[model samples]
Target: MINVFFDKVEFFANNKELIKLIISNKRDKKSDLKKVIIKLIELKTELKLSFAYNHNTKDITKNFGINEGIILIQNLLKTDFFNADLFSTNETVQLISNKNNKVKIKTTEPTFKAIPKLNHDRIKKQRIFTQNNIYLQELGIISQNGKIKKDKHDKFRQINKYLETIESLLQESYWFTSGKPVTNLRIVDMGSGKGYLTFALYDFLTNSLNLDVEIIGVEFRQELVDKCNVIAKKSGFKNLKFEQGTIEKSEFKRIDILIALHACDTATDDAIYKGITHNSELIIVAPCCQKQIRKQLNLTNEMAAILKFGILKERQAELLTDGIRALILEAYGYKTKVFEFISTEHTPKNVMVTGTKISQKKNNSEILEKINSIKSFYGIEYHYLEKLLNNLSV
Candidate 1:
């Protein structure tokens, strides 16, 4: 991959400066363009660049294959045009290369390819989804804020809150816990810290409500998993168990739903990909540290430094990380939403991404447009989720 050069020119913003670097840095536009494009894709994949981007061009020159350049007549200095409100921005760039692979415009609605659509008849046959959300009273309490209200035992009530949230999300549609058609509901909790919520989720899924569930709490430390497993068994939860595994290579199989809370840095990305590859139906992830982007912010040019302050950099990282995840999910044909998870006794890193797979093939063009735009905004590529999505699940 080739590296990008910065220009001392006074016409563009710092973010656009990077784009200018790609366009003007090299002497021979055609030869160096390929290297530059490889570099861009690498940056997108490795560094997770281009998260804040809100627009993409079909211009041949920007295509990086010695192709044509797209010409846009919009106001380049305006921020509002690329700030997501204009999802239908009319940016044009013509593809120049003719004797090559003619890239076809992707259909917005993705047809079910590998994963066969579930037999909706089975669900209709049995009204398992007609039941109400499981209210685990013995689990714990919740405060005015979404924070879990703990008892004298320090049982994190946040787990109950999370489960309740999940239940509510599921209740809006048809669902089930233990049947042949719905035989694949697995929840893997990345960074199951103290397992307080783990136990609570288990009790709620199994004891309070008679549902067959397969719950796996993933923790790096063997001691914690062992202790949690012991506690779960003692609590009479046969299906809920803890295991020792890292985010990179966990034994996640047929995961219908994933719940990740505060898996630091790239680990959150790891958990999201894990769930995605396993064909999980719903993904709920809350990230912890934004240090990775914080470092990148420090590398920002003087222009960005002047506009966005120190704290703003961190906030940008947080938004970009979660925003990129949302795009990747959308790119994969999932309906994605982002919001605050909960403000608990825990730290204040409370951004959550919820993604549910589309029931049918829907337009993916809009999702792709959103993704490309966000990527341009942040100058990032290949987020953790995108990395996995680009590769096989081995």
Candidate 2:
């Protein structure tokens, strides 16, 4: 049997185990390897992944003659360990050098040379879940650092980007007033379920960056809230906490950054309202459902023509709803931006509306007018955003 093993002298996620699994499942090993190589090339083309395997070794390595920048080990058990120089050419990828816990074999070499060693300890340290000790958290109720359940791909990506963007927004001058910078960053995540992003953000700001941040996650589920609280306590994160609250009834206070990720439709709007009401410096919303907008569009007379086509009407409703919300933010002196969080391919509805409350141009009349014009063109009335625009100060 031609045995192949991948050793982490390169990267953890790119271990030889992946090759073993692929080779085992594949119909034609060579063809499957070819596919993998092609996939690597494709990833390289897109700059999604860097080169992984190293190029040099002893006599056995010469026999294999690496493919996809990889060498197959015929007797992987005999060898104690191996490493892939994923970033031999450029130091940016990684410098891996580690032992095989199972085989008890170890190898060490310079990063660029054929002999490589992946720093498994560092790789293990990098995984957010492991590094943060999420596994130790309670079940049913998710803690701030709880292990994320599978099948939440959409939420994961959105939450990650939303948190980072808010951090970046804080650095912008528009988010400040009278040149008085908002140095003490306080953020609250409303309807914060599982706190995948909440914990992720705290990890970034507090542990990784060592920035002094006050972070809170508010969720209706008491269990999840309690779980988060425990995790916060255990992590020794004084600035992080979780509270039980609803967006509608929750009393939002002194929040510099407010985020609502996939707060179910109108709930997302409510979260936005609370942020603006509390005079939050930055508001980022990734709304999940648009059921309210969908229903309102059906009832409004102006939307009748567009409603003629169900598909067209649905798309129109989505755009109109978000557009009105954008205008409302503008009315409150918040500069709003709407963009795709992911894609329809990933999940049809991916809407992120970010707002920075600009003091001078709080209520940009031009932006408000443009939003109205868009509504008029689409015959969209009974807009939730428009309703709120008149309720609060810009």
Candidate 3:
């Protein structure tokens, strides 16, 4: 038997008919076939693909914005060599051909796709972090039967999304200088309630990304810290541990990433201050509770009518609080971004703030003036983050 792989197969212009034939007979029992995937187009904004399955029935599952790039498969004993032409902005393609006589292969550059749809069977079959993960089971995200709990479905998706974001961020060249890989990383997760995300991150960084990393999850609850430590030990995550401490009290000499998800009121500020003080490479937080700014926001003359409404005032405070935090991060020589983390259906506190430290310092007098003006206009004495950083050098 001969086997071959081709990366430059021209599908639309040449092999469309072949792909059609392959999908049409996807369920042929004699073929020993599994499935056929056809990526329709790669747009700058999204990805499109059709999955043709060959289990008990043959059906096509069309999906949009799937992140998996390409897959090629061949079965030599059955002469079932399958080649798929994956459409993309760059017109990328892959093909596998196995025959009795000879084999041939071709390769080329690869392009990235979007995250796969949730219903896609590949999500379960080829999960990057499997359901059998001991930490996930210990955390009750998955059942003892190695299945995701029905209620924890959203939680599972959130974990995957979190890992995906971190994976993409790690690929940036700025994180690695002169092609030297980062072997050691110290990550601190502030307010790590239940440690659901902390465990996922540690697993991905150590098991998936293959990085040597030490992770500390700081939670005020001693019970939770002890529980998480037990889970970490059971899962054999030697470099991953939990500590009973608040974000402000926790100290680390060196930190690579500082993460705080849904830290309440001023805790988000504490996390950011720690990241900035340690000069961490990355800081990510999904802030919750903006009462600090909301409580001090009086009905100013400029916007008394709108600010008088409770709902509007609350919404405005959330935005302003996070906005100021982003600006503060920027002024501290970190590139910052604020965006919706997830839908409100999953969690209302879904706004995520990301800060990546840059080499240049940017705490100019103008930035300070802007910060102060915003505070004064809202009648806020000090943004929690600002108050924390007032004595520290930016």
Model 2, 1-394: lDDT tens per residue? Answer: 1111243422423432121111111223333222111012122222112222221331111112234334432222123222222222122122222243232222333233211112222222342443335522433223455555465555555545554565456545343223333355888889888776677778766654445679888899998898778877776778888888887787755877888888887888888888878788788888877777776453346556657898887777777777778777877778788988666666665678988877645646787788767766655566664565466554
Model 1 residue 286 lDDT score: 80
Please give the clash total of every predicted structure, in order.
39, 14, 4
Return model 1's CA RMSD, one decimal: 21.6
lDDT (Cα, 0-100) at 266 in candidate 1: 87
CA RMSD of each candidate after superposition: 21.6, 13.6, 10.6
State which candidate, 1 or 2, has the greater lDDT: 2
Give the CA lDDT, 0 to 100, for residue 91 in model 3. 36
RMSD of 2: 13.6
Candidate 1 C-alpha error for residue 11, in Å? 72
Question: What local lDDT does model 3 show for residue 85?
Answer: 37
Taking all chains together, the TM-score of candidate 2 against the true structure is 0.57
Candidates sorted by lDDT, descending order? 3, 2, 1
Kindly give the stretch of ten consecutive residues in candidate 1 with the minimal lDDT sum: 1-10
* Model 3, span 309-363: residue lDDT tens: 8999999999889999998988888888788767778878788999888866755
